[model samples]
Target: MYFTSALVSRSLIKNAGIIFSKQPVPKNLYATRLFGTSLQKQAEAFIPKQRIKSLLPTNNSFRQAVTRFCSKAAEPAKGQKAVGWWLVGCSGMVFVAVVLGGVTRLTESGLSMSHWKLLGEKPPTTKEDWIREFEYYKQFPEFKLKNAEMTLEEFKFIFWMEYGHRMWGRCIGAFYAIPAAYFWSRGYFNKSMKIKVGIFGTLIGLQGLMGWYMVKSGLEDRFQDPNDVPRVSQYRLAAHLSFALGLYILFLMSAFDHLMPTKQHAIEITQKALKLRKYAHISKGMIFLTAISGAFVAGLDAGLVYNSFPMFADRWIPSDLWAISPAIKNVTENPTTVQFNHRILGTSTLALISGMWMLSRKCKLPPRAHTAATAVVIMGWMQVVLGISTLLTYVPTHLAASHQSGSLILLSMAVWLTHELKYLKKLPK
Candidate 1:
C-alpha cells in the first residue's frame, strides 16, 4: 500500500512539472507572423492610390497645402520691403516738382526755353550759347509783346528756372521706372500686381506728354489778340494739373497697398451700409472739381482780378464776371467768372466734407474709418483756411503753392476716407 501511494505522488509531480515547463515555438507559425506583419506595414505605407494623384487633382490629406486654382498674394521678405519706401520717395519728389512747376508758372519763366531738348544733345553750356538762346527768344510773340524791354540777363534767369523744372521731371521718371522694373524682375509682384503697376507707369508717360502738350499751346499764338499776354491756355493748364493730381493719387494708393496690405482685408461693408461710401466719393469728386477750377483761376490770372476775397472789388459778384462771349466761355476764358467759380467751389467743398463727417458720426464706424473721417474734416477746414489766406495774400507764390499742395493733401484724405468706408464693417452701437 505504501509503495502504490509513493508511485501515485511521483506521477502527480511529473504531470505538474510538464504543465509548468516552457515549450519551443513551431518554426512555420513564428515565421508566418513575422513575415505577415512586415508585408502589412509595407502595404499600408507604400500603397500609392495609383489613380489619386491625377484623378482628384489633389491629395485629400492635405487640402490646404497647395492652392491650384489661383495665385496667393505674397508679402515681401520682412524688413526687406524697401520697395514701398522707394515709391514714397518718388511721390515726394513729384510733390516738390509740382510746387516747382507752380513756381515756374508764377515767375513767367515757362516760355524762356522756347524749345525742349535733352540735356545731352543741346543744353546751353557757354555764355555765348545762352546769349544766342536769348536772342532767339526775342523773335517770339511773348518777348516782342510782353517783355520788349527785358534784357538778356533777365532772360537767363528765367531760362535756368524752366531748365531746372525739366531736369527734375526727367529725374522723377528715372527714379520711378528703374526700381519698378527691378522689383518686377525679382518676382516681387504677382499677376494682378503687374497689371496695376503697368497702368501707373503708362500714366507717368502720359503726364510727360501732357507737359509738352501744355508748353506747345503757349508756344503758339492761340488767339490773335496782341493785347492779350502770351500765356498757356487755361484748358491745357487745367488738364495738366488734373493729370498730375491723378498720378499723385495713384502712387499714393499703390504705396499704401504695399505698406498696409493687412488693412485691406480688415473690413467689408454690406450693401445696406454703402451710402456712407457714396457720400465720401461725392466729397472727393467735389474736391477734385474745385482743384480743377483753381487751375482755371491760375490760368486766367483771375486771382489778380479779385484781390479781395469774400467780396470782389467792392462787389459780391464782379460786374465784369461775363467778360467773354457766349456765357459758356465765361467759365474758363473770363477771369472774373473763373475767380467767382473758384470761391463758390471752395466753399461748397468745405460744406460738403463737413456734412459728410457729421453724417459719419450718425452711423457706427470701424476705428480706422472713424479716424479717417476725422482727418477729412480737419483737412477740409485747413484747406479752407489756406485758400482764404492764399486769396487774401493776393496769390503770393508761396501761399498759392501751399494752397495747391493743401488741396492735394485734402483730396488724398478724402480718397483714403472713402476707401476706408468702402471696406468698413459697421460696428454694433
Candidate 2:
C-alpha cells in the first residue's frame, strides 16, 4: 500500500510538471507577471525593433536583454563630455603648434636644429655645448649658404625656437596618448570613436615625421649654388602644413560630435536646411582650398613677391606668373604664380562664404549653426584683411604669423558651420 501511494504521488508530480512545461512557460515568467510584461518586450518598445532583434538572442531573449540595452549607453555622459573637452584641448595644442611653426618659418629658425630625434634631443646648456651645437648647425646647408655670419648667441635663439616647437609637438603626443588610453580602457569611446581616435594618433605620428622631413630638405646638398636659398622644399612644406590641418580637422570634428550631438528637426524645415547645408559644405571646401594655397605661398615665400593687394607687381597679373617650365609647374613652383593663385583662392573663398552667409538669412538654421555662419563670414573678412596686412607689411613675423593663424581660425569656423549643418535631420519635402 505504501509503495502504490508513493508511485501515485510521483506520477501526479510528473503530470503536473508536464502540464506546466506544455503550457509554454514564458522566460522570466515571474518577473513578467510581476511587471505585466517581459523585459525584452519593454526593451522592444524603446529600442528600435530591428536593432533589438539583431542584439538580443533568438533562443534566450531575456538572458542578455539588459546587457545589450544600448551600445551608446555604455559610455557615461560625464565621460563623453570629458572626452570632448579633451579633444578641444588637443585642438588648441595643434593651434599653438601651427602658430609656433609659422613663427619658426618666419624667423628662419626651422633648420637650426640640424638633427632629427624621435624622442627629442638634449638642448645645449653650457657654453661649450652651445658652441658645439652651433658648429653642428654650421655643417648644414642653411648655415653654409644663408646664416654663415650667425654668432653663437644668434644660433642659440634659433635653436631654442626650433627646440620649443619640437618639444610642443612631443607634448601634443603625450597629451593625446595618455588620455586616449585612459578613455579607451574606461570604455568612454564607442566603436566609431575608437576608430577615429586611432586615426588621429596615427596622423600625429606622421606629422612629427613630416616635420623632420621638411627640415631635412633645408639641410641637404640640393642647395648647390651659392645663390640658392637654403629653405625646405615647397612641396614638402605644403604637405606638412596640410597634414597638420587634416589632423586639426579630425580633432575638431570629433570634438563636435561628442559635445554637440544632432537634434531632430521638423519635416517642414527640411528643404531649406538641406539647401543651406549644401552651401555650407561648398563654403567649407573653398575655405580648406584657400588655406592650402596659403601653405604653398609660405612654402615659396610668395608673400614677399607682391606686397600689394588686388594687384600683382603693380598689375592685375604678373608677366612671369607662368615663368616656370611646363605651365603646371608654375602653379606651385613659381613664386609669382603661387602668390597669384593664393590671392584668387582667398578672394573667391571670401566671396563664397559671404554668399553662403546671405543664403543663411533666407533659411532657418539651428541657433548654433546660425552663429557659426555669422562667425565664418566675419572670420572670412578678418582673414582677408590679415592676409593683405601681412603682405603689405612685407610679411612681418607678427603679422605673418597672425595671418597663418587667421586662415586656421577661418577654417575652424567653416568646420563648425559644416558640422552643425551635417547633424540636422533632413526630411522629405
Candidate 3:
C-alpha cells in the first residue's frame, strides 16, 4: 500500500511539470510579444493617424522616409546637372554666333569672300595668297565698279570679316562635337537624345554648306541685275536664317530637357499644355514668317531703300509695286514691295502674339510656367518696339544688328514659354 501511494505521487508530479511547460506564465507571455503590443498601442492611441498634422517634411526619420518616397513617386528624376550645364554653355555660344552672323549680314561682309576652301588652302597666309585673293575679288562687278579704288589693305579688311564668320562656324561645330562625343562615350546618352543631337549636328553641317551656297550666289553673274554688284538671293538668305534659328531652338529644348530640376509627373497637365502648344505653333509660324520677311527686307537692302514712315515715296503703296514684268518679279527685285510685305507680316505677328498672350491667361499653370509665359509676352512687345525703331531709323548697322538680337531673344522666350507650358515631368518607378 505505501509503495503504490509513492508511485501515484511521482506520476502526479510528472503531469504537473508537463502542464507548466506547455503553458507559459502571463508575465512571460506579455514579454514575448512586448514590441508588437507597444506598436499597436501607439497606433491606437491616436484618434486619427493622418490628422496628427505633422509639419511638412517632418522631423521624424520615419516620416522623412515616407515623404521622400511620395516625392520620388511624383517626380522620378531631375535633369542631370553636369549634362545640363554643358548644354547650356553650348547654347550660349550658338546664340552669340547667331548675333554675330546677323552683324556680318547687315554689314554686307557675307560676300567679301568669293571662294570656298574646306582645308589645305589657307586664308592668305602669305602676301602672294593675299594678292591672289584680292585679284579674284577684282574680277567681280563689286570691285570693277562699286569698290574700284579699294586698296589691298581695304580688301583685307572685308576679307577678314568673312574669314572671321566662317571660322566662328567651325568653332561652333567643334564645340558641339567634342562634348557630345565625350558625353556619349560616358553612357550619358539615351536613344532618343542621341537621335536628337545627331540631327542637330547634321543640320549644323548643312548650314555650313548653305553658307557657301549663299556666298556663291553673289559671286556668280546675274541675269536680272547685270550691272549690279550681286548680293545673295533673298530666298537663300531666308532659308539659311531659318535653319539657324531652328538649330538654336533644338539645342535650347535639349538643354531644358537635361536641366529639368524635378521629375514630377503631370501627364494630365501636360496633355492640356500640349493642346496649348498647338496654338503656339501658329505663333511660331507667324514669327518665322515675319523673320523671313525681315530677311527679305535685309536681302534687297529694302530698309535702306525706303526710309520714310507711314508711306513709301509719297504714297501708302509705292507706285513701283507692280513695276516688274508679270508682277511676280516685283516681289524680289522691287525693294518697296518686299519692305511692304515685311511691314505687314511684322505688324500681323505682333497683333497675333499679343492676342495669344491674353488668351493664355485663361489657363491655370505652374508658377514657373506662368512667369515664362509672361516673359514671352513682354519680349514680343519689346521686339515690336525694336522692329519699329529699326524701320524708322532705316535699319542702321548698330540698331539693325540690335533689332536682330532682339528677334532672337523674342524667339528664345517664345520657345521657353512654349516648352514650360508643354512640359511633362518624367515618372519615377
lDDT of each: 0.73, 0.82, 0.71
Query: TM-score for every candidate vs. truth?
Result: 0.77, 0.82, 0.77
Q: 2 or 3: which has the higher lDDT?
A: 2
Weakest 10 consecutive residues, lDDT, candidate 1?
62-71
Which portions of model 1 show Cα errors greater than 4 Å? Answer: 1-80, 118-122, 222-225, 262-273, 425-429
The backbone clash count of each candidate, in order, is 0, 0, 1
The list of candidate 2 runs beyond 4 A from truth reads 1-78
How displaced is residue 298 in candidate 2, in Å? 1.1
Q: Could you tell me how far off, in angstroms, the CA of residue 386 lies in candidate 1 after the best superposition?
A: 1.8
Q: Write the per-residue lDDT of candidate 2 for residues 41-94, one digit (tens) a residue.
A: 654433445555544445544333332332222234449899999999999999
lDDT of 3 by residue, 1-429 (tens): 434543453343234334534432223222232222222232223223453342122344443333232222223233356677877777787788778777888877787787787641367888998988888888876666567788999888788877888888888888899988988887777788889879989998888898889888887756235467567888888888888888888888778877754344354453445455566777777877787778888888888776777677688878778887888978777788898888888778788777777766766566676677678778888887887788788788889988888888877777777667554543343
Query: What does each candidate score in C-alpha RMSD?
Result: 17.1, 9.4, 13.3
Residue-level lDDT tens digits of model 1 in 1-429: 434543453343234334433332223321232221322222223223452233222332222222211113343443325766876687777777777888888888988878765432266888899788988888787887799899878987898888888888888888888988888888776777678778878877777778778887887865357696888878988998888888777777666666655343334455444677788889999999999998898888888877786888788878988877798989788888888998999899889888888877776667777788899999999998988888888888888888888888888788678766654554443
Query: Pick by TM-score: which candidate is best?
Result: 2
